[model samples]
Target: MSDIIRRDPRAEWIARNRLHPLHAAMQPAQHSWMGPNGVIRKNVHGVGFIGPNGIKRIDRSGAQQGGATKRTAAVEVQLPLHQVPSPAFYINVVPDMVGGRLSSHDRDLLGLARQLAGSDGAVLAVVFGEHKESAFATAGVDRLLVLEGHEFDGYSPEQRVQGLRAVDQQFNPRHWLLPDSRSGGGELGRRFAASLKERPATRVWQIKGEECIGRAGAGQQDLARPLPRLILAAAECADPISDTRHEVLPVALSTALARSLPRIEDLGAVAVDPAAIPMAEAEFIFSGGNGVKDWALFHQTAAALGATEGASRVAVDDGFMARDRQVGASGTWVTARVYVAVGISGAIQHLQGIGACDKVVAINLDPGCDMIKRADLSVIGESAAILQALIDAVQTYRSGAKRDAA
Candidate 1:
């Protein structure tokens, strides 16, 4: 009996049998407390005994309780859609799109493009080849133009330049925005600008009413100039769009794009150890701190998740991790896409280090910690249990995915 998974039959029966003697005992506890506006009430998360799957399972079908799903639906944020029926002009953006997803740099550029487009113009995104990103609508793209072809795949900058030229000839956008980042965007933007015989703003950080301010003289001075047609913007040039959504309407060129002969041969990605990667360059970071009780388990968890390991200042000082692995203002500042802080209390220095990270997930016992307040997602619980459960979940997902693939 101890080994078998118990069903929530009693809860299920009581939901249907409301007139029974003890129906209320098994019924789901709901939000009956008065809301803010005096007597107003809302039915938010319902309470019941944990089911076999760790959620309340009863006859009620309306309450769906997958852990991830519940968290996302907690606030039910619906950004208002921004649509442009007829655009006066176009502001184009080419994202680095590292790993087939929009980086923080990409989103920031889109936000800048949104500012440039305003209400009259549209923010158009130019994607080379296929991508896995589905959030272009929320990322402030009014029009999405994906130039898909084998010729555009893998280190083919010459081919990509030709594709951009074709877009320019057809759309003749008012502005071209690309990230002045190490991951291909900067070089490509410069190449495209040269093709069009237009001088581009490079390493651009900010834009004023009619002038653009960018770094000059080895980051010693800021160069202000009139806004140019082409811009290679740096990270954090603008905040990403969060208040509204865009149409993301698909667009295509009328004529076939010109093809360029390949000067660079395509080589696939090379494997590197997660430990060998520096925190500054890592995409996913799993960090630990003083609250962690099991160091071995934490290391195992990081490995299972395939994340680069990082540690708080306290953890490094305590000799739990290497000094090189410390993450803070005094340590390495990271711009990881997803930063999971296991037990770190959010120090100001630590927060500053990860300020540029896109998402922060905090797992700790204390819900009121500074880390919890700063985290995009917070899971308040015992670290050991959470880590173990996470490892199991990852294994399950991988196994399921492999089975489906096979």
Candidate 2:
């Protein structure tokens, strides 16, 4: 029945088994290439997405600018992760104000996820919040696990850590990804790395290898494990220029430094407060800037306000105000309900620190500056005159209230 003619015994055997004559003479292919169990194998891995802010639709086009605060996350299929034949991916769902809405930062993260997903595993999502009509109904996830609780509301660093640790324990993922934000992402990333004794690169925009080594021997790199996790914290703003010869070079340097060290430690818990950011619990905020003119004006303004007066670094250099209360990137990060910026040009470096406030009032002679643009209210005048008037007004208001109560 078979198209074969028997000659010598070995020749007949080779002919019957469909083996090439030269290969048979040398060695058998199955014994050399096949596994002991006659099967080829590869390890499976998982990637996790920890979204604290969550996804929301922010309309930055300036046309009726508004967006709903909701949390939505998505995963994409692509390179190494997806291509690995049996990999898994998960999304850590924290309360996201911006749901499903892709900001420039979100798109960058998503792009990386998709590029790395190549057929290795299925991407899954774990959402935390009340179930909605269409919460985890995205295309990427193979299955969605919805966790419900009030702890998901707002940004709780401790709660997030617990949730992520739980996910990692259950899923056993090789990589854990975090989106960089002002709130608490960086601190969490560093803490996780330090706690696990694992090497984590934050603000990572791309990944090169997802290979596994097996087991680390002395300096031989950790193998036996799947692969190194890539954590990306894409910057919402563009990178600062690294030029020192220009006029704005100092500001550029300051911006670069801020980017390099964005994480602010919990100064209270730490024994030594190196950053020297003023405590937010100050009753009186005596702030100074270019407007104070000189050191005498600084004291005069502080006395007039009956508050702690401070100055900008420029003021400090010009011998106008003290080193403390200099609120900017290099200076302290203040959170006073009432913040006054006198005689100061609102540089981007300065604004980043104070922008998160209840209300901000600007007092500047040059009304066209950026400070005026970002302030809640702008008073166009000299700092000395305004300070006197404000002091009088505050005193009168307090006296009137006391009298009325009597």
Q: Kindly report the root-mean-square deviation of model 2 from the true structure over all alpha carbons.
A: 25.8
**Residues 1-406, model 1: lDDT tens digits:** 4798878887788666645656645655655543211223323233443321133423233335433332333556465678999999999999998888998889879988988988899999999988999999988899999999999878888999999998998999999999998889999999999999999999998899889999899877889999999999987677567667788999998999866568788888787789999889898999999999999999999999889999999999999999999998899989888999999888878987887788899998877666887899999999999999999999999999999999
Query: Looking at candidate 2, what is the lDDT of residue 274?
Result: 20
Candidate 2 C-alpha lDDT tens digits along 245-304 = 111000011111111222333333333322243434443455667776545655665665
Alpha-carbon deviation at 142 in model 1, angstroms: 1.7
Q: What's the true lDDT of residue 78 in model 2?
A: 26
lDDT of model 2 at residue 195?
A: 60
Clashes of each: 0, 29
Q: Model 1: what TM-score?
A: 0.75
The prediction achieving the highest lDDT against the true structure is 1
Q: List the residue pairs that clash in candidate 1.
A: none
